[model samples]
Target chain A: MKNNQGMSIIVKTVTRVSVWLMVLYAWYIILHGHLTPGGGFGGGVIFAIAMLNVLLAYGSEFTEKWLKIRLLHDIEAASILLFLIVGILGISVLGGFLTNFILKGKLYELISAGTIPIFNILIGIKVAMSLFLAVLILAKTNIENGGEV
Target chain B: MMPTEIWLIFIISICIVGSIVALELKDILSSIIAVGVVGLGIAVSFLILQAPDLAVVQFVFEIFAVIILVRAFLKKDYHKEEPSTINKVLVGVTLITLGAIFYLSLSVFKLLPPFGQPLFETAQYYVQNGATDTGAANLVSAIILDYRAYDTLGEVTVLFAAILGTLTILRIKKSKNSQEVTNEK
Candidate 1:
């Protein structure tokens, strides 16, 4: 029952050192989206790219152990629903659909942009999960063919 | 920063060369790499035009797009057939037409406002009043997530539809696969 999979040592070492750093940078990009150039979509894709890198270096087995594909699908669906709920709550609380209803914080403050940051987090999670699931399914396809893939 | 014209020239030249390299390279991987170079060149053009937001978006999009394309390529045969003469003729015609169109468009740029300067009233409003109106420092974020929040939601909905479509296709494949397994059993 020795099932060690994935690429050679060099790629694994590189991924080990770089992937977490990229994930952290992606979080920074998502959090500071209102104050910076990249927002949820871009940041989320970057985060997903890091996970894809892991899948590339370590194989689907490692990825499955880390994050089951079914869970990824659920996370993506739930995040989309959460996004809609956030919008509906805006209309309920402020009487305007998708209104920037959160109280304005001090300029340049972390909590200043109100709903934008929250939306950023939601969108980031949604996009990351969606991309990861897509990549995972595609990579794992042909697996049922006696695991020839 | 270099002069706008110089930046434009560098970007355009890189784009042309990259596109040609992508078209002419015999190796599929090299062609994809060349296409990536073209993508970077276009993103640089966006940055030169003072749209960092667009540049960042386009650059990240290009990366993922290339990844997906590469995956698709790996799933198939990499045939190296020479492009037909008709294709060469079409490329020549297209390039000439595009060159003529670009030359014509160069004159039109002078008639338009300077880069990053909003010409329309609404755009001007965003530039001048966005900070106070939306209470967000990044005007682009304020516009996309606040002022035009509904539009962004619609865009995200479209993305959801696309993802769902892909998932449905995959699920069908999985179902067919399971049926085959059961038949074997």
Candidate 2:
């Protein structure tokens, strides 16, 4: 029972606790993007970093066994498709591509900003999955090569 | 409170010093850490300049950059090989060219508008009516996600292409590895 796939227990425990918090913070950034400094790209990068932290702590082998890379690829593709669809839908509704079609509620509210939040969420997902997939592949390749270039 | 110019100058000097240290350091790891420090200085300067969004992105990006660099370094030797002898003539020529370029660019720099003042009216419009039009309190977000969404779409497409390229390259490597294994068997 080598069980040496990841780091020491202390690091694993800390990562397990912090990973969820990071995800929550990422969601906050994405959801409140219109009202905050960070928007889709920033939130998405934060989410990707959270996933990367998990991979680093758990090792690629354990992570791949648990997390399906195929599913991530599908989600990434779907998010991009949805983003494009949203843009096209604005053309049909408002005669402008990527227009703010939704009803913009009062300012400073959570649900205001008419399609901006939607875009934020979609972009966040796309970015997170894209980055995670890239890093996952890199980690897998490195492992296969036995840490050689 | 001290003027923003003083704060900017101080932070920029720190960044310059840190970069010089990073370049001069013998240990690769220490150099990487020095670069990280310079990035932190830049993030701080961004914050001082009232660009919290850029500061946040820079901060997180710096973390990722340092992590990736350190991880890659771990896979190989940490110590540098021998330092190559510098060519004094080449250095002199490079310095002279750089100075000439700087001298030529001074006129262009003078022609540029002063800081916090833009020659374009579009910026003024965005700053004034961004929140009212987009219903987003953060003007930066409003501009990015609402006003110039097409630009953001283009950026997302670029990210998608980069990821697609990475996966394709890695997948080809995997297939080659499998083929080699099968041939050996």
Candidate 3:
């Protein structure tokens, strides 16, 4: 059972190659959210899918080794707090909560959207961490119960 | 390409069929797959309606939901409980009630302004000014992150709370045997 934790070798190989591309794509969506249809939540889910791919291909051991649950929890908490701080900054400096305070550069260009990109990045991190933690907990509990939940 | 109106009707039919298949199927895995099809169909419809943001969200969420549900199913024996008479009656009554409500909602939706027409001034302003004001090309992103950021924050909090609730409900204590085994180790 230990040896048979994941799928076949072909799947493992494909996952190994696809993981990098998938992660890159997710980041692209999150960072370019101001211009594109995909936003932080969608990008974050894509990241979760990448994590899921690793877990599915090589088992939870590889996932735990690569990305620690402690790190994910920290990211989750810190991202949310940072998001709140960004909102508070708006209230203090911009006269409203979550106000667009940054300078609006030319449209369609990256880094032009005031706080939208920041929000996207923060949401991406928070959502990715939360989803990763959820999947990890599910997998761990399933294993603990002798694969019987 | 076929006219969008015709395509929409076809898609709606597919959604209806997929849902019925999902409901009737007893095999847990098959039912899950059918539900995924329904989700995908709905996502595609969102795309057709020019809501790329909604489509992306619907598509991504559907995939994750299917994957997680499959994982949960794998952990348990797929022994579907036989429906008792009371359960059957409850389902029947609920379905009928929902069917009536759904029909009425459809009629109400038809009464609304046609597509591409804004029913509110606020929406018109957002469409006209969101890009220049928020500096985001994507109006949805501008609205979510800048215009209604407070609302988005509340939504984010709700999501976190929901996840926390799931964790709390599903939590279990370590058995005595497991504790002893750990101690021995």
Best candidate, lDDT: 2
Cα lDDT of model 1 by residue, B1-185, tens digit? 44897879888998999999898877888888899989988999989887888898889878987887676455545645365557578878999999999998999989988655666777888989888877788899989899998898888788888888877676555646555676888
TM-score of chain A of each: 0.87, 0.91, 0.89
Best by TM-score: 2
TM-score of each: 0.84, 0.89, 0.88
**Shift in Å, residue A99, candidate 2:** 0.9
Best of the two (1, 2) by DockQ: 2
Which 10-residue span in candidate 1 chain B carries the lowest summed lDDT? Answer: B72-81
Q: Write the per-residue lDDT of candidate 3 for residues A42-79, one digit (tens) a residue.
A: 99999989988998898877778778777777788888
Q: How accurate is candidate 1 locally (lDDT)?
A: 0.82
Error of 2 at B180 (Å): 7.2
* lDDT score, candidate 2, position B157: 89
DockQ of each two-chain model: 0.44, 0.54, 0.55
Candidate no. 2 TM-score = 0.89
Candidate 2 vs 3: which has more lDDT: 2
Q: Which docking band does candidate 3 fall into?
A: medium
Better of 1 and 3 by DockQ: 3
* Cα lDDT, model 3, residue B25: 75
Clashing pairs in 2: none
